[model samples]
Target: MTKFVVVEGRTLKQAMKIISAIVERYNTIPILSHAKITHRAEGLRITGTDLDIEAHIDLDVVDGGGGDWSVCIGVQALAGIARAAGVMDVRIERADNAMEARISVGDGAAFYELQILPEDDFPEIGGKQGDLIEMFTNGMLTATLDKVSGSISTEETRYYLNGVCWHITKQDRRFVATDGHRLSLCTYTPEGGEPASRIIPRKTVKIISNHLANQNLKIYDVDTGKLDIVAPGITIRTKLIDGTYPDYSRVLPSRHDFTLDLKRDEIIAAIDQATATGGQRGAAIKFSNQNGRAVIERRSGDFGNAKVKTSTPWPAGKVEPQPFAFNSRYLRDVAAGCQGAIEMRMTEPGAPFSIFDEDKTMTRVLMPMRA
Candidate 1:
C-alpha cells in the first residue's frame, strides 16, 4: 500500500520554519533532525522536537487521499526543497516499504526522494493537558520577555538562573531574569488568579517569543510540570526547569541616595565610544559626577583610551565628585533597550545601582566593578 500526503508548498514552507526552531542541526539521534507528519480527517499536523522542546503546526491539506500514517521526514531537506520549488504547490507520497518518501513540486516538474524513519521511533511527549491556568495576549508576554531576556544567565553551571521566572504576586504577574550581576523585572496584570510559579527555560522563552509575535496566546496545564502555549495554528510544549529561583526581592535596593537623569541616546553614545577603545575582558567604564555634570571615561592598556562628558544634573548637597565604575558591556546592554530619559539611582561606588525608564515599569540592576 502506497501512503501519501499533499501539502501546498507555501504552507509547508511556513510550517517548516516553525519546526526548524526545535529541530537540531547536528544530532547523534537521527530522528531528532526529522519532523513527524500525521494526516488527519480535518487537516495535516506537523511536529518537531529535540527532546526538550516541541512545536506543532496544523494546516489544511490540499488532498486527503493519503491514508493516515505517521512518518518522520528530514526537516532541512523538506524546507530546502520548498524554498527552491518557487511559488508552486507541493505533493508528497510515501513508499510502499515505508522506508522513503517522494516530494513532487509544481505539477511534478521536480521530484526528490527523502529517507524516512518509523513513527514508532519518535519519542512522544504529549499528555492529557491539566486545568486552565492563565490567558494573556501575545503582546504582553513578548514585551515582558524583551525587558528581562538580556539578564538571563548563559552559564550552564547555575542551571536554575538560565531562564525567566514566571510568578504571580498580590499586585500582578511578573517575569524576572538574572545572571547574578544584573537583574530585570517586568510586571503585568494576569487573566486569572495566581498559579504555581514556573521557570521557563531560556530556549523556550526564545521560541515562544518568536512564535507569539502579533498573535494571541493562552497558557494552561502548568501543574503537569510542562508549559503549554496555544496560539492560532500553533502549539508549543516545553518542560519547566525543576529548581527553586533565588530570593530576587532581596536583591532590589531599598534606598538610592544619589539620582541622575540623562538622555538615553547621549549615554549610549558615550558607552559606545568608550567600548570602541577595546579593553580587557569585562573592562570597566568610569562614571564620575563633577560639578552637576556626568563624565564617562574608559582606559584600555592594549587598545587605547577615550573620554566623553554629558550634562547630567547631580544630586544636590554634594560638593565633591562621586565616581563609580561598571562593566562597559553591561551598561550598553541596559541602555540599548531604553527610550527617552533614563534614571540612574545609586548609593555609592561599590553598591549595585539601577537603570530604569521614567515610568519604572521596567528596571535593570547592575553591580559596579572596581575602576
Candidate 2:
C-alpha cells in the first residue's frame, strides 16, 4: 500500500526553517542531506541531523491517516516545493513502488515528484545520555549566545576553542568564547541549581540560536558529551565538543588605570567610518583620549585615512592619555554587543582592555594591536 500525507504548506515551511540549520548541503552519506519525516498519532515529526547535531520539530498536519510511515527526502527539494506551493494545502503521496513521493498543490495547480531514500538507511541521532540539568526560558539562552558567539574561534586546529564554554561559577552561570586575541563573557543567575559545564560546538550554538530564538527551553544530560534541549514541540540533541575548555578566569584583568565612557551609537558610528577606509588587508584603528574626548583614527595605503572624535566622560584626575591600537573588526564586534554606553577600561598602551555593557553582565577583553 502506498503511504501519503496531506499537510499545510505553511506548517511544512515552519518545520523546515527549524531543521534547515542542521541539514548539510553536501555529505558523503547521501541520507544526511535529507530530512526524515515520520507520521505519528499526534502529528508529523520532521528531523534533520549531521551526525554531530540533530534537530527535530513536531508539526500538526491534516491527517490523511497514512498509517505510520517513515521516509527521507532531500531537504532543499522539500523546502523549495513548500515555498513554491501556491495554495494553503499540499498533498504528498508515496508511489506504489515506495521509492518516490509526489507532492501536489491544491487540485493539481502544481505538481512535483521527489526521489526518496529507504527510512531504514537513516541514522538515528539520540538525545542526552546523562541527567536533566535545568530549565530556562528561550529568551535567556538566546541572549547569552548572542553575547559570546562573536568571539568563538574559527581556527579548527584549536578545536576546543571553536565553541562557547558554558559553566556555572559560585556567583552565576557563565558563557564564554575566545579567539586568543579577544574573549567575550556573559553571565546570568542560575535558575534553581547549578548545571554541569559543557563546551558547546559553534555549529550547535548556531542551531540552538536559530531554533530557540524566543522560546522557553530545558537543558538535559549536560557534561556527558551530549545535550538534549527540550522546547515547545521541538527537541535538539547535540554532541558537545569532547575537549577541555581553557581556564578563562586567569585572563580577566584585575585592575585598570583609566576608564572611558563613550556613547555606544557615536563610537560605533566612528568605528564604522574609520574602518571603511581600510583596504583588502585592513589595518588597525588607533584609539586615544585627547583632553576629555575619545578619537578613533585609521589609515590605509590603498584607500585613504579617516578620523572621528567624540566627547567622552573622563575621570576627575590627572589622566595620562595613552594610544591603544586594535583590530577594527574586533573593536566593532565588542561595540555591537553593547546596549547603552560603551565602557573601556585600559591599563596601558599595549595591554589588553575590557569593554562591557552598562549592566556589566557581558564583558569583552581585547588585546591591543601594534599600529
Candidate 3:
C-alpha cells in the first residue's frame, strides 16, 4: 500500500511556508521536526505541530497513485527541496508499511529520500469543531491583534500575560494583553458566538497575523480551553493557555483631568528617537509642559540628551503638568500600533494614565516612573 502525494513545487513551497510557523525551532523529539503529508482523495495535506499548536495546509494534486497513508518528512529539509524544485512537479511516495520514503523532483532530474516517521507518531491537537464560533475578516483579526499583541508579556513567571486574553460575551468581544507595566485592550464586533474565553499564546497570535494578510475569512473554534482556526484550505488548532486573566479593568484609569492630543507619528517618533541610546533593560522618558508647550526629553549617559516638541496644545487656565518620567520601553510597545491622534490623559504626574484614539476602540494604560 504505497501512498503518495504529488503537487506542484511552487504550491508545495507556499504550503510549507504556512506549516513552517508551527514547527518548533527547538525540539528534542525526532517526529516533531517532520511534517506529516497525508494523501486523500481530494489532495495532499501537509501538517506540522509543536505539541502546543497544530497547523495544516492542503495543496492541489498533480498526479499520485496509492491508498491514503501518511509519511513524515523533515519540514525544513522538504521546504528547501521545494524551493529548489522551481516549476517542476513534486512527487513523494513511500512503500506500504515502509520506513524509507522517496521524493521525486523535476521528473527524476533530482531525487531526495529520507526515513519517514509513521503518521500515527505525529501528534495532533484535536477538538470537536462543530460550528464557527466566531467569524471575522482577515483585516479585523489583524487589526485586533496588532492593537493589543505588543503588550503581551514574554515573562514566563507570570504565564498569564504571555498571551492575549480573548473574552467573548453575548454582548462584547474584546482582546486584552498586558506586560505588568503597560496594558492594551481592543474591542471588536464579530458575526456571532456563545460566551467563551481563551488565552491565545503569543506564538499562535503571530502565526495568525502572518496568514491574515492574505486570508479572506477566518473561522474560530473556541471551546473547553482550545482554539481551532480554519481559513480556506488551512487549519490551525492550538491549546489555550490555562490561566486566569487578571482583572485588568480595575487598574485602567477612569478619568484624567489633564489631556494632550498629539499626532500618532509624533508619538512614535519621539519614543524611537529617545530610546536609541537606552540599554537592554529600559530607558526613562520625561514629559512636561515647558512654557505652555509640550516637550519630551530623554537623557543618556554618554549619548547625551534628546528632545522632541509636539503640537499638543496646553489648556490656558489649567495648572502646568509637572515633569513626569515614563519608561521608554513601555511607550515604545504601545506606540508601535497607535494611529490617528493619541490622547495622552492623566490625573497627575504619578497616577496611571491612558492613551487612545478618538473612537476609543483601543486603549493603552501606562504607569509613570516614580520621582
lDDT of 2 at 162: 92
For candidate 1, the TM-score is 0.95
Off by over 4 Å in 3: 190-194, 218-223, 275-281, 315-318
Q: Regarding TM-score, does 1 or 2 come out ahead?
A: 1
If scored against the real structure, what TM-score would every candidate get?
Answer: 0.95, 0.92, 0.92
Arrange candidates by lDDT, descending. 1, 2, 3
Worst 10 residues of 1 by lDDT: 187-196
User: Candidates' lDDT values, in order?
Assistant: 0.82, 0.81, 0.81
Q: Per-residue lDDT of 1-371 in model 2, one digit per residue for the tens? A: 55778889888887887667788778888999999988877778889999988877888788566588887889999988887873468888867665888888877888888899998898976643567676777478887887899999999999999999988765578889999989999876643245456899999888777768888888888445888888888888888898989888887888988888878888878888887755854369887666767788887777888888877754446767567788888887788778898778888577778887786678789998987
Instruction: Give residue 90's error in model 3 in angstroms.
Output: 0.6
Candidate 3, residue 18: the lDDT equals: 77
Q: Report the lDDT of model 2 for residue 230.
A: 84
Question: Model 1 off-target regions past 4 Å?
Answer: 190-192, 318-321
| Candidate 2: segments with Cα more than 4 A from true spot | 127-130, 190-195, 280-282, 289-292, 313-321
Q: Pick the winner on lDDT between candidates 2 and 3.
A: 2
lDDT by residue (tens digit), candidate 1, 140-206: 7777787899899999999999899997766677889999988998765534355557899999999
Question: What are the RMSD figures for all models against the true structure?
Answer: 1.8, 2.3, 2.3
